[model samples]
Target: MARPVPVNLALRDRRIDIFFAVVFSAFTVTSIISDLLPTVGVDFSQPSDNFFVQSNYWYAHDADPLFMNPPDWMRIITGLSAFVYMPFYIVLVYALLAARNWIQLPSVIYATMISSLTGIVVFGVEFFGEPEFRTQNAVKFLLFNLPYVLVPLVLLVRMRKPLPFTRRF
Candidate 1:
């Protein structure tokens, strides 16, 4: 007798996973393209000259030579690179986590999610901060390429099990 067909749930899940992988890859490709392009060097002016900050070492010192009281959001965005690598570090930790079980899949997914969130927050901060400090290209790099890194990890994990039709081919 023929074996019973796999449940639709598994099929649906697989399809969604594949879709995510493709989307992630597309984002990575586009981000690379945008990064390669030359900056237009267009200048945009900001409204305020000074910034307001709480009592912190960096805050105590002049954050920007031009803007005495740059907005809090601007300060964070200007320094976003400090946090951008955290997601990548998480991915490596998850790689170790993967060795314990199939936990890598979730870890990879979470890494992507975290990276996306980081990108969004950075973008918002930059937008609200100084007009000259805008860096959408940096945000694009993180959002697009970060997810693609997980796709290969997932594919390798899934290849262990063969489908029923594979024997006939």
Candidate 2:
């Protein structure tokens, strides 16, 4: 009889998971507070159809995008920050599901795939296009991104498992 192959739990590298958690936490929170925070004063009262269109125009031209627009470099940094949120959330939720004594591996994998794809799209837009509608976009981005930070923190606090160790320490 052929020997059975051993399953690789090495795929579950706890060190990397913890590292991701830390890095993602830092990136997401910074994006939310430092970059997007200032956007609170952005003008969003333009005509409905012109909102996003105007924002992107300014983004493309490297001009002041709105009433309280920051410099282009700042916008780039903030936009890029939005990209990492979904993957962070995905990994966090997957971690929770996996650590739960009940959920199956297939379900965890499915959740990860979905969240990873979401992160890709979020990042892809920032990569290929500049958002024109400054205030609306910033608000929507924050709404989507904040949960990633909160869910993981809450889970890490409540879960019994030692945080998946990372290379940080």
Candidate 3:
């Protein structure tokens, strides 16, 4: 039989946890809001010219499109995020703010699933799609998307063990 390792109720580093929570909270909130707004017309592909959409489109519509001309699958996944993942992120933000230990396992699972899906999409587009669909700058693409991948991965590692079912802060 496997022995259960004890988890500390107190956060190992309060500052880091708070920082990640704030960043992700902001990102998820913005994503949800941007996606929810009505586009300029009936075109689901044509997003409104709001700050968030414009900023995202600027990079997406570049010479070697990163997000501007995403495949149908990407669009569908993003749409799902607006409804499903956005709410999940909201819950995660609350959990993080409360320093709820119960969030550890779910956080790890979320990280793994999201990161893996992102990897599959990015790599799949790069390899299977038309050459023009590939990102113009590999390094820039990775850098831009690194946080989404890294944050969850780090959180997964940090929360590998079970945490106490109590608030830390």
Candidate 4:
């Protein structure tokens, strides 16, 4: 077996990876605040009763009313984000910081899942949902949620090669 050569990846030059690390770290927190909270029984049905949702304009805006109504499928995805994806976001924060290559498969999976969930399921609910379920602020909703799709897609492409951290965009 041939030994793989170690690439000297300078963190100073890896600005984008650092951005990804910060974003994933932020996601780690949001997974808890946004997704995990809902899964753990903090009701989103009435933002008036939910402290975070009530206090935060992002949630209170009702941009994505799915949070307010949260059907079974939405609950499932929130549970998934809380239990599965939240952990990944934590690991991803560390992985991106350390430039670890092993995160490729898991990140790809995360990207695909997030893209499909937000890109298809979420947007579908927001755009095509019954009037009651649709967002009152479609632009704001899309602006806030777009990163969930765009960032993962960027990471998906970033991880396409071996030693992904060594590669620069």
Name the top lDDT candidate. Answer: 4
lDDT-superior candidate, 1 or 2: 2
Ranking by TM-score: 4, 3, 1, 2
TM-score of each: 0.30, 0.29, 0.73, 0.89
Worst 10 residues of 2 by lDDT: 160-169
**RMSD, every candidate, angstroms:** 13.8, 12.7, 4.7, 2.1
Q: lDDT tens string, model 2, 1-169?
A: 9967433233255444455456555655555554443333343334335545444344323423332344454445444444444344455545533443232343344335434433454334433446652344555454645454444444343332323222111
Summarize candidate 1's per-residue lDDT along 1-169 as a digit string, tens digits: 9988543233233453445445544544433332211122111222323221121212212232212233454344323322433333344333332322243445445445444544455444445545654434555434443444455344344433434112211
Show the lowest summed lDDT stretch of 10 residues, model 3.
36-45
Stretches off by above 4 angstroms in model 1 are 1-13, 38-121, 133-169
Candidate 4 structure quality by residue, lDDT tens digits, 78-157:
89988999888888888888877889899899999999988999899888977778888988888778998899999998
Candidate 4, position 20, lDDT = 92
Quote the lDDT for 125 in model 4.
Answer: 80
Query: So what's the TM-score on candidate 2?
Result: 0.29
Model 3, 46-152: lDDT tens digits are 44566666656554554336356555666665665577667878888778767777787778778877788766776567546677778777676776666767877
Kindly indicate the candidate among 1 and 3 with the higher lDDT: 3
Candidate 3 steric clashes: 1
- By lDDT, the candidates rank as 4, 3, 2, 1
